[model samples]
Structures are given as C-alpha cells and as structure tokens.
Target: MRYAICFTPTPSDPLSQVAANWLGRNVFSGEMVEPPAIRGIGIHEIAFHTAVPRRYGFHGVLKAPFHLAPDVSETQLLRDMMRFSGSFQPFRIPRIEVARLHNYFSLVPSVPCEYMHYLASAVVQHFDRFRAPLSEAEIERSDPDGLSAAQFANLHRWGNPYVMDEFRFHMPVTGPVNLVDMPRIEQALRNVFEPVLAEPVTVANIALMIEEGTGGPFRVHSLHPMGKVSARKIA
Candidate 1:
C-alpha cells in the first residue's frame, strides 16, 4: 500500500460533502456519492472525466504518494506526524476559484499565499525520512526524462517532483475534460464549489490517506490537527 499526506476537510464539512458528491467518492468514508446532474453534461460524461481523480478523492496533495521506508512502520509514521503537526498553527487561504491547471480542472487559491508554500515545504521535509526511495517502475511511471532538471532532481531527492519550489496547492475536482466540453464542465464546477469558496478555506488539519494497492481508491487513515502547544520547561 502507498501512503499520501493530504489536506482533506473533515467528513462533516460542507466542502467535503460537496467535493465527495462531485468526485463520486468520499475519501474519508470510502462511500460513493451521487454526482450532481448538469443541464448539458451527461452522467456518463461526468463519470468518465472524473474517473482518474475520483480514485484520489478530494484534497490538496501535500506530499504525493510514496511507499514507507523499510525501517519505518505505519505506527511510527503516525506518531511522528502527530508530533510534526503540533509545531505549526492553522491558517486560512482567503479565497479559492475553479481553474484549469494545465489540462485538468481544480480549485486553486485565488492569490498566492506564502504560508501555504511554507506548510507544504515543511510537510515534504518533515516526513521524507519515512519515504522509501522511488523504485525504477515508479521513476519510469513519473516520466523522469520528461521532467525539467529541477523536477528530476527533486524526484530522486524527495520521491516526488512537485515539492518545495515546485509545489502548488490545488484541490483537483476533475480528471480531464475535452476542449468542447470545457465550458460546461467549468460552469458546473463553479456552480457547485463557489458557494463553499465564498468563505475562507481553512487549513486546520492534515490527513493521512492510504491507497490499498495500485488503481485502488484512496481512503483517509487519520487526521492530525495543527497547533497543539508543546510543554516547555520553566526556568
């Protein structure tokens, strides 16, 4: 099984419910949700386009999936994650919007936030020791030759190319849409996600998501909230 560190909303959060409905799977609960019907979009079309992302569920990828190192255990990883989470305080992104990132649609921050980058970088660094080095199959799957020099270096170093400087926090809502279908899909996403985006998006907790095996749907393993104060010795 592979593990990923992500930013999933609590199961009860409206954002979680809405996104689960859109993607047709709740990563937190492992239940399927009915996708909303759109005027011009067929249910099959919605399902088709969402097929890839539906497996990943709804969350910003904090640390892309990786196998645990031979020396580490899931219990050890969990304990460290809890300790790491306590070091940072929760923060918010002022707003988010539906945008086509490269060829797919996702919700991205309306404006850049430095703190978001800092948090992502910290996550990548903090748990990297638990990550097993990428295997040859994994490297080929990532298309290392297609990556820029910096990305290639990051892949070998961090086991994920999109880390540190390359990280851009985005909550994917769809897999890929055809050019002719872009307008309809964009509108559909905006209609569903805009209301939730009207308020600030909170970054209160970090989640551990587990994929049982290749091509399996990822499920939430645990959530570690930020901002627990560590006791200090009085002088």
Candidate 2:
C-alpha cells in the first residue's frame, strides 16, 4: 500500500470539518463518511470526479505523495521520524479563511507560523526514506507546473521538486477553476466552510494517509498527535 504522513484536521478543528463536509464521500469509497458523488450536482463535481481518486477529499498535504521504499524498513523509518520530531514545541497556525492558487481555490494561513514551516521541514528532513523519486508521469500530472530541467534534476535528488523554497502552504479546494463559475463556486465553498474559517487552526496531530489502489481520493490511515512537552528547567 502506498502511504504518506499528513496533517488531517479533526471536526473540533472547524476548518477541517468544513473542508471535510465540502469533500464528503466524493473523495473516497471505504470506511469514510459522506455521500457519493452523483451527477447533476455541479460541473465541478463532474470534473473533480474525473480526476480525483475515490478516497481523496479535504485536508492539507503536509507531506507530498511518497511510497514506502521496499528496501527501507517501515519500523525504522517511524522510529527515526519520531526521534527527529521530539524536540519541537507544539504550536498553532493562524486562521485561514480563503485563498486562490493558480486556477484552484484553497485555504491558506492568514499569517506565517513557525509550526507550519517546522512541520514541512520535518517531512522533508526525515521522511526521505519513504519517498520514491518522482516519475515523468507524476510531473506530467502537474502539467503547466511541470518541472523544468532544473526541477527534473531536483526530483532525482529530492524525490519531490516542490520542497524547501518551492513549498507553498495551501489546502486545495478544486482542480482548476473555470472563470465563469468562479464566483458561484467560491461562494459555495465559503458557505460550506464558514465555521472553519472563523477559527484558529490548532496543530496537535499528524496523520498517516494511504492509497490502496492505483487511483485515489486518499484517506487517513492513522494519526499521531504531537504531544505537548513540559519545559525543561534550566540547570
């Protein structure tokens, strides 16, 4: 099974709840809740269904898609990731209501937060063992965002080109927006996710997501809460 560690927000985390509702069962076909995507709901649903996996919907991706390496043992990788993650204090991100990325709609942090950066960096830093080098097909899926020669070279080295400086934190709401429907879709998203937008984003856990099949609407495999640390007394 292909797997990745992610930050899956819970219902108590309103933003996540709303995003979840918006995506519903349209994202997946397993134990996940929400109804299936049926025709005539909207154009976005039709198009989204065409490109999306049955188990995918909602939440931001802290870690890009990576497969567990056959040669690398999973037990060792989790232990190393936990050890590496032990030092950081649990922190929160500012509220993110609405934002746009290229042709897609997204939820973005209202302000920059160290937790976001640290989390992203951690994924890049230690989870290196799980990821396979990005293939041409993966890059092709990116299309216009397709890697240049420099990016292709970086993929060989980093397994994902959008690491470090290239990383931009945003939770995608759609594939690419059609200008004519932009306003209607935006409002629909706003209405569906309003409760989440009104609150601050609490960062307490990291989720492990998996893809059981070739096509995905990926869903949570497991979750690891970032435990709070008591401040060490100075010697």
Candidate 3:
C-alpha cells in the first residue's frame, strides 16, 4: 500500500475522538465497529463508513498509497518517517467553515496558511521515495463516477484530481447536502462542536498512518510534532 506523510490529529485529542465517535455512532455497521483493533476508536468508525471505506480511521493522508519494497517493514518505515517528521516540530491550522462536495459537510481554515501548503508539498516531495504515481488505468476507475473532462485530465496528470490549484483543506463532517440542508448541518455541528471551532485548532503534529495491504483500516503509526523542535531534529 502507498503511504503519505500527513499531520493526523492524535487519537487522544477530544476533537479526534469526537470525529471518530460520530462515525461509529452514525456511519459504520455494528459488526464493523465490534473489532477490538478498530472498536472504541473514532477514526476507525469514521474511516469505515464514509464514501472511502478503507480510508476509515485517519484525518490525514500524508502519502497516497504505494507498495512497500520487500525489505521494508511498516514498523521500520514508521520509525524512520517519525524520526524525519519529529525532527520538524509542530505548527497550527486555522479554523473556518468549509463547504464539501460529498453530499455533506466539513470544517477548514478560511485561509490556506503558508505552512499548510508547505506541509502538503513536503509530504509529496519527501515521500516521493515510495510513490509510483497513479496509472492511467487507475484514472479510468473513476469513469464509473463520470468525471468531467477537466477532472479526468487532472487525475491522469496529478494522481489526485483535487490537489494543487484544486486543493482545499477540510475535516469531514456529515455527508454531503444541498444548500437547503446546509443550515441544519451547520447549526447541528456548531451546537455540538462550538468549543472546537471557537478558536483555531493548532496542527502542531503530523502522524504517519497506515492501511493494510490493498484497502484496510487506516491506523496510527507514529506522530511528529512540528516547529523548531522538528527543525532541530532534521538538523
């Protein structure tokens, strides 16, 4: 499976737990949620139910999926990736309301912070060691969804149609909605999560998350804090 270097929120964070619980309570089937490895975790519940089922369990996608070489163990890669990221310290993410394309909702920063862009770029560049870029056949997989011509072209060129100029940072919430339903979802979210949104959530750390071969539940591998500490580690 491919990997990415993303700053996934720590599992202990209240917000992270909230997001996960929301998924377990509202999305995944009870059977899926019962597994000990995945049960009692918010990300697992969330990752399992959303449109991307295997994506169930992470708030970050640092590296897109890639096959690991026979010699590389996930633990070894994680320890190295963590050391690489930890050397970097931590940073912050702004808070804002964001509209989502998935028939539902989300929250994101009003402005794309320079650091956020840097982090995304860093993941792609630094993690390129394992990536094999999306193949043409992979792009064709989306044909069932009937993408627009421009979108199709982007997938072939960029692996993900939503990156670069098309990128928008968001934390998922209720699934998609029409303008009419937005008000309700927004109010509900605000009522329950006002504390989370009252101020910006600092994205001080990036976490390495892994999915088992093919599509599997995304699990936390390691976390690296951002900032001077991180920089010092790299130095």
How would you encode candidate 1's per-residue C-alpha lDDT over 173-194 as one tens digit per residue?
8887788878888998888888
In order, what is each prediction's RMSD in angstroms?
Answer: 3.6, 4.7, 6.4
lDDT agreement with native, every candidate: 0.87, 0.62, 0.55
Report the lDDT tens digits of candidate 3 across residue range 1-235: 6555555466666566555554442122212333223333344433433445224453644455555555567776766666666555455666655455466666667777777766676665565554556666776765726766665665665456555545566666655456775665556556545565655666777766555467655565556666565354431
Candidate 2 TM-score over all chains jointly: 0.79
Taking the tens digit of each residue's C-alpha lDDT, what string does model 2 give over 5-108?
Answer: 66657545555554555554422224444532433356456346323422455656767777777778667666655655555555667677677667778778
lDDT (Cα) of model 2: 0.62
In candidate 1 the C-alpha lDDT for residue 45 amounts to 81
Decide which is better by TM-score, 1 or 2: 1
Q: What value does the lDDT take at residue 25 in candidate 1?
A: 88
Off by over 4 Å in 2: 26-54, 139-145, 148-153, 228-235
User: Quick one: RMSD of model 2?
Assistant: 4.7
